[model samples]
Target: MSLSLEKILSEIEQLTPEEQLTVMGYLVELVKKHLTQAQPKHKWSDLKGMAPYPLLSEDAQEWVSRTRREADEHRERLLQGEE
Candidate 1:
């Protein structure tokens, strides 16, 4: 590692736990900002037809409704002590 990095690491090591946590939170926010700036921005229209109908071999609304019904039935059975 570079001398500057080593020096910074040494300095960080001397910080109290609370100070270290504060520094860590600052670093995390900096990293998040960098990542957001680096990513390409996309408009909603850009995702159009990305997954056309039947992409999952089922209609989206039907799949959603079917899954909800199945989940409710399972939960009802579990509440009734019927595995």
Candidate 2:
């Protein structure tokens, strides 16, 4: 280790037990904050090209309506014990 680090370590060793624990806890929190801030922050535009036009073989609005209708029909069948 470097001389400066060795000196600092010696100083830390001379502290009371409670002070050492406090320093350790502070260092842990510092590392946690750094890691949390290092992650990327995404925006709506980030997903702009994730799904291209039409998204599927059919029109997006038409596909959504068709799926909703099918779900309602399936629910009715189940409700009437017709499944």
Candidate 3:
């Protein structure tokens, strides 16, 4: 709609596939930079009590055990080349 955008689009259309991909990657990085600058940073204490349920020590232990078991199984499967 804007003249600048129209000009950019016309130029992009003329680029080779690889050049277009490079321009797209550059644009993605620019968008990520703008987004990070616009967002606010949070401290760990500020996120306290954010969970719906209270997290107890036992709950944490159980979670660690389950994750470890799953990871070990995954590694075993990978070593065996199992699909």
Candidate 4:
């Protein structure tokens, strides 16, 4: 819903001390909601290789490849158990 400054001022004036606090809380929540909603959605795959600096060493790269291959083979073996 669209809000006008006059409407907001009138609403503020109508609020009790406790209600005013609630209104402030609600406004903060509203700002957070809108901000997060406006932001673009992303995925790990979408940002793959986008790092400003490389975070892996040559040994770490080798370990990652070996671990991934082992995990794939283990997954296949587990699937074979199901069959």
lDDT of each: 0.94, 0.92, 0.91, 0.87
Off by over 4 Å in 2: 1-15, 79-83
What tens digits encode model 1's per-residue C-alpha lDDT throughout 11-71?
Answer: 9999999999999999999999999999998999998989877877998899999999999
Candidate 2 per-residue lDDT over residues 31-61, each given as its tens digit: 9999999997899998888886878778889
Question: Which digits, one per residue and each the tens of the lDDT, describe model 4 over residues 15-37?
Answer: 89999999899999999999999
Worst 10 residues of 1 by lDDT: 47-56
The number of the candidate with the highest lDDT is: 1
Query: How does each model score on TM-score?
Result: 0.51, 0.60, 0.50, 0.42
Worst 10 residues of 3 by lDDT: 51-60
lDDT tens digits, residues 14-81, model 3? Answer: 99999999999999999999999999898999988887553753576788999999999999999899
lDDT value for model 2:
0.92
lDDT of 3 at 22: 100
lDDT head-to-head 1 vs 4, winner: 1
- Which regions of candidate 1 deviate over 4 angstroms? 44-83
What's each prediction's clash count?
Answer: 0, 0, 0, 0
Clashing pairs in 1: none
Task: Please list the residue runs of candidate 4 whose C-alpha ends up more than 4 Å from where it truly belongs after superposition.
Answer: 1-3, 47-83
Residue pairs in clash, model 4: none
